[model samples]
Target: MLVEFTALHWIYVVFIVLIIGFMVKRWDTSLISILGIFVLAIVATGDLTAALSKVFNSFIYAITELLSTILIISLIVAMSQVMKKSGINEVMVAPFTKLIRTPTLAYWVTGILMMIISWFFWPSPAVALLGAVLLPVAIRAGLPALGVAMAMNLFGHGIALSGDFIIQGAPKLTADAAGIPVADVVSASVPLVIVMGVVTTITAFIFLRRDMKKGTLELVGTYDGEKVEEKSENLLTLGQKKFFALLIVVAFLLDVLAMSLLKLTGGDATALVGGTAVFILLLLAVVAHKKKGLEKTTSYFIEGFQFGFKVFGPVIPIAAFFYLGDSGFIKIIGEYLPSTSQGIVNDLGLGLAALVPLTKEIAVVTLAGVGAITGLDGSGFSGITLAGSIANLFGTAIGEGTATLTALGQIAAIWVGGGTLVPWALIPAAAICNVSPFELARRNLVPVVVGLVVTTIVAMFLI
Candidate 1:
């Protein structure tokens, strides 16, 4: 059966296809393609006023919904900067270096550290910390900087950010679109995340082993100035080390307490992290620049915001176009698209469901593949809106048992696009390690591809 395409549907398909082409070719900025979609939507509706309204309203609505989360991310970044300036970040990772004596151990250690920190603070801040501290250690331990980057990308961006069990941002986004509780999405994501994590990590290890065998392994700092030499004397004063250690321990405990007492999840959890970061920043800044006072504190915050925007800004417009596909966002776009009971992505998915033979196994693979492909645009969470809509539509068309299939698709899409497979997503990590983003992406290719394959298989049997 051929799916019937409405004018609106045709517009969206063209927009999505063109965007995908732009990404594959690296022709122009994604922002240009996104703007083109906005123009196309307006032209389709044939209303200048409506298009103008959508331009302003849609951006406002999208920003407002995400404002708190964004602010929190900025704050946490700022705190990381403070920690770096204070030498606390180095102190934090120094102990771990002793355990990561070899290249292979470096990969696993970096992955584990990324996963733990990302679960609490989100991957963005986690990347900064890892890059600044653990990266040098891994490099010194005979791990390639590119390899260190891949490990961080897979564990932090792919595994931790994808499941978002602690912060709940990813699941919350999917659940909101699915019309289900955030807790339900979180519960469903746990097993899928574990499976993906194990597969991706093991695949990465295999590659690391081959590199080791070839004697191609180089210390991470060979290309950069990040090598850590073992000093006979501790560089930091004993009092300073003790104070920072207590500070780190207290901060971690506060995060746990906040998560437990406030029951914060998703955006709220991000806020908690960000708030704690600010508190830490203030505490550290005051100690470091007591004479400079509030002016220095202000500068630290500005620096943090700069980092946050640098990391997240490029994806905003891309997110805006996808937001147009949702019903909640259609009104923001104004009368350009008529209000229908169905979301654009949902309508399209339902149409496909009618034609496709969505058995249990087929459903899982199909959804996961579609999710991963949609994420090719490089904004991982942006695809969840599409995945959720598709899941709901196709789940109904196939069987009630397909909810997990939908969730699986959501997970795969974000995990891959969010930063794992995309060069753009790994920019901070690459920049910090002074490695090439494209090469880092190449390093991640096999592991992420194998992981996705394994994840789909696991989802089929488990879900």
Candidate 2:
């Protein structure tokens, strides 16, 4: 079937072109692109009277709908920040240093830590903590900073963030788009995640081993060759340290209890995590700076919000563009299509499906490859909605494991875009480690690509 373009469709195309061009040229802010799209949509529909209303209405709606997930992310980030200032971040990774005495162990430990914390917190915050604490240890153990970053990126942002099992952020988005239950997506993703994780980590290890043999390791320290200052220790008082430790333990225990007792799933679980973070933040601010009064308390929260926005702001417009592909948000454009109409990305996928005479094996590989290529634009999660919809369309025609195949696509997309192929996403980690982002991307290319290929093959057979 030929896809017809209405005025709204033309507006979307124009918006995408403008956004992509701006991103490629590094000429426009994400906020500008997002507002541009909204404005264009309103103008296309010739609804100036409603345009003003939509400015506030659309943002409010989106924010409200995503409030639970965003709050959870913000709280987790704030908690990690608190831990960093209190020295718990150092303490948390201190024991791991002993265990990761060798380059091989360093790679595994970095990957594992990134995965665990990224699952609960996020890769952005996890990168800061991991780079501050674990990077030095890994580098001193003869691991390259490049290798350390690769491990963190592939495991934390690529695999863990893509799966988002603990927080359910990525899976929730994919599930919502596919009109599938979040539990179903999460369950189906387990095997796919295992395949990708094993393949990616092993490939990264191979690269690390090769680098180690070459004796190209660089350690993180001051100019005089001493370990970096123990910034964390000097930042907190003794009482503050004790209080944060107790608070962390209580927060974690409460999380476990909430998950167990309430049987919270998806957004509910995310809200529980966020709520706990807020409670801890409040407690810490009160106990630590009680003498400063309410002004200090407000300042801490403002700091938290600033941190959250800094990390997550760039993602909003990117996400908004992808949201255009979702059925729920399409109505906002005010152009109704037939019930049989497919979103633009879905239409593109179906077109590919038609042209490619793919067997089950070929289908899985093709899907993975396509997803990875799409992710090259530098937003990992951006491709999932497209990939998920396509996977459902194509996988259903082939056999019984559609969800698993869909998940394979999701993994490839995230592993590539999350940080491995893109310098933009690697900025935080690279800056913290004092490494070159472009070089980090170069080092990640081979291992991550090889891993995605192997994982796709494994998933083809298993799924």
Candidate 3:
């Protein structure tokens, strides 16, 4: 169907273009998003008072939609902090360092473990979790600090965040935007993530070897030709260490078993992670610090909430704007305006269906570009709604799989803004590895660019 546009549709189009322009200029979008909602609401409601109410309602809607994700991330971080303090984290990974005595082994093993942990606990927590324990080991193994950083960066942020299979945060955002089920996007993301992950890590490994051969493997971080020890402050006994480690493994294993038997997925699975983290925090606190456990537990809550809200702050306004382009339109404006012809961005996107002669290749590449552009603000997720909305538009236009296209945009956004390309976003991994964020971004450019290209091409076939 050829879509017809109204004055409201035109306004939304203009707003979208302006939003992209602001992002391209590397400006924060909170003001622009709020302004967009203000103007869109005023025009839609035809009442200044009613329009003003929408701005607040929109943010509340966005927050409500995202609270579960924010909670899970915070809880996981708090759980990780306790694990680190209890020395369980060090014990958990100690066995791996014994097998990582060579540069190549150090690179592959660290990268693999980082990916696995990042998938479960997220890169924010996993960086400290993996880096503190494994970083010195990889460096002591004659692997350059730069090499270790690249391995951690690509596997954790690039591969794990891009797919987000365990957390489902990235997929859920895009899937919601595309008007599809989260499970479908997760299902479609596996192959694309694997393709991107394999190609990018392998390509990065080749460059690491090439640099090593050229004697460029010198430490960029703190390593200076001396043996290093694990960075730990906890003094737990060996038996205590093993016990906590075992406790953690069993807890998560039970969660896994529950998921399979209960058919838990998406938000349900995420709730399990969050709830388990909270329980772990309490148990570990009591076990590790005894009388000080109460104080430490409260402190963990403070740290986790601070970090969670900080990340959530930048996203709320941005997501509020796009949520209006999805189901949020009705929720935010329904009291005053009963319905919309279609969601604002959706209308704009679908209206262009016939205007642009889109082949599968063009559609995939364009959506990927949109996804990358949205990531310029450096939060992989805040921009996902746009990617999902555009995928839905393109899918409607071309008679293809909406989930596949949505997954493609999701991977692109997360890989870039999630930490691979953006210097500011790469700080966690870079700081832990003691390398410049700029250099890490520079190292990642080639492999990530190639991987995105390969993945986008593969998406053409799938779509």
Q: Pick the TM-score winner.
A: 3
lDDT of 1 by residue, 1-463 (tens): 3454567776776776676566545454456545755675576667887777676676666566556656766776677666656666667777788889888899888888888878766787777666777877787778887788778888888888888776566676566556566677777777888888898888887887798679775545234434332222233465775687577668877887878898876666666666677777777777766777477789889987896566556545655666666665456654444444266666666676777766777767767877887677677765665566556656666656445765687778877778877887767677777777777788788888888888888887765
Clashes in model 3: which pairs?
Answer: none
lDDT of 2: 0.68
Compose the digit string of candidate 2's lDDT tens values, residues 115-156.
887876789878877787788788878777777877888888
Best by lDDT: 3
Error of 2 at 331 (Å): 4.5
Task: Name the Cα RMSD for model 3.
Answer: 2.7
**Candidate 3: C-alpha lDDT:** 0.84
C-alpha RMSD by candidate, in order = 4.3, 4.6, 2.7
**Lowest-scoring 10 consecutive residues by lDDT in candidate 1?**
225-234
Which of 1 and 3 is ahead in TM-score? 3
Query: Residue 162 deviation, candidate 1, in Å?
Result: 2.2
At residue 332, give the lDDT of candidate 3.
Answer: 89
